[model samples]
Target: MVESAPVAEPAAPVESAPERVSAPASEAAASIAPAPTPAPDLDPGTRRGVPPVAAPQPSSVPPVVESTPAVAGTAAAASVIPGTAALPVTGGDALVLRGVTKRFGSTHAVDGIDLTVPAGTFYGLVGPNGAGKTTTLSMIAGLLEPDRGTIHIGGVDAAAKPLAAKRLMGVLPDRLRTFDRLTGRQLLYYYGVLRKLPPAVVESRTADLARAFDLEDALGRSVSDYSAGMLKKVMLAGALIHSPRLLVLDEPFEAVDPVSSSIILDILSAYVAHGGTVILSSHGMDLVERVCTRVAVIVAGQVLAEGTVAEVRGELTLEQRFVELAGGLSDVEGLEWLHTFSD
Candidate 1:
């Protein structure tokens, strides 16, 4: 029998704060059970003329697409933000934040921040470590409540209508924190059922997702038995079981293999092409330059620059611009002792 616990899903409609899971070591035994029968109701919503994804890399995978100004992204008819970067602000309202702030004790993780992501666009968030990218995304995913400021999801006020807002989004949190005791199939089942999808639809989508992410054989095993890359893939599968209007993914390509990462990018690009919106944070500047229609660079809890890929990078590349805004590289004088080994 498998060890059982409450299936901790991604961005469920929990009234209180979201419960986080601590992933432990994998178990040895697992039953090779077959997945439920699949049907054609599963729609990943793949379309063409989408963003351009990055070439595959072995260690780190990035879904960085290269989007031109004429990419024809999400509906651009929404309201313009207070101080968004210089771009033709087109697209329906996917997410909007004004004066968003968060603090941990005395540390201000996220100071006053404003962002607007249009529906159907692949938006990117780039920042150095500890730059509040995760904090901001957490707030957007409804995992952490902001100290002050308002959040709107597709024109729905998140505070007043949390459940409604959550229904419109599929969130992939930073770490692989979830109910590891259950089989991957069981976890995905809960993820869909919690969102109120019919059992058959969930089953069908589970098979589809497993096939797409190459987790067909592993779906019967407990999530705890999954490797880092496998865990990322399974959790991602769970996140997409429901065809949500907006997807909030944090560092999704981390730990995934190059082939899997390419598959993920194709799926996301197609989803965006068919009117779904995605906002994710990544450190891959090249990936961001290739995959994102618009990007925002956060530094010290503030956005230094925000605009279309072409606009933000200007004459310099995205990496160069990011380094320039992040204060460039520091001197290596302090680490000189390491070079002078006591031979």
Candidate 2:
């Protein structure tokens, strides 16, 4: 019992000391330690996977650019050209005018007109008896000079360069004067020569026109012996023999028969389809209304209105609009003698 007691007391006398604690370092002392070595060539300004810093640029340096001397010169030259304001002309249309005016003494036959005929367009010029339609067309055809304006044909200046402009045009004046003694075929031949068309082309075109116009039988006869309709057909054939880019006509259907008129209209339509230009003047408003893609209506030597037929008429009928704008045909309609029956 005494040995057991002694062992228990010894075990009780054994004591444990408190565990030791580590002290925290100051922020300034931690910062003084060297940082881990950066990866090779790593930029200090960039984060992981980011691009390296760019070299500094000079603030006074200007941007680099290429120059276009030829293009710049062309644009500058085009700006200086007269009539550049008229239009941005292109293609092979026979006639164009801008601000065109013609005055015969005090009569302003045409006043400040602008016209553009695209290649392959059948354009109509229409107006009352004394309207300036004819005068406007004449200036375009180079038959008369405009008091103030510019006319271009196939990009050739009409005023400054008449010959080159006229070369692109074929004209049939309102009152045509032909040699009465010459036969129909001979007349066409003469005009073909005057136009300086090649002989082969002249021959082929003449033959085709004679057949198309039903003038083969009358070709050998003198123009003086032909009827009014026949003469008109002959003159039309003459006007077309050279295959001009632009064909100008004044009242091409005046003396033509219904059958001939239909044929001529078809021919003109085909001509335009094949890249030819046609500027025709006619008092037959109904025909012009039917066939023209664009029209200019002149009254008292001034353009009263211009546009497509449907555009100009708006809600009113073309005939009604025509009457309203150009004055009613009441004076002519008032004639009562023609209705009287003979005894």
* Cα RMSD for predicted model 1: 14.7
Where is model 1 more than 4 Å wrong at Cα? 1-90
Q: Encode model 2's per-residue lDDT on 77-134: one tens digit a residue.
A: 2243222111121355556788998888898877888887776677888778778877
Deviation (Å) of 51 in candidate 2: 88
TM-scores of all models? 0.75, 0.68
Identify the leading candidate in terms of lDDT: 1
Query: 22 in model 1: Cα distance from truth in Å?
Result: 32
Can you list the residue pairs that collide in candidate 2? none
List the lowest-lDDT window of 10 residues for candidate 1: 25-34
- How does each model score on lDDT? 0.64, 0.58
* Candidate 1 lDDT by residue in tens digits, 180-293: 667888777766555444466556557667766778899988778999899877777666655556788889888888877877777677566656678999988888899999
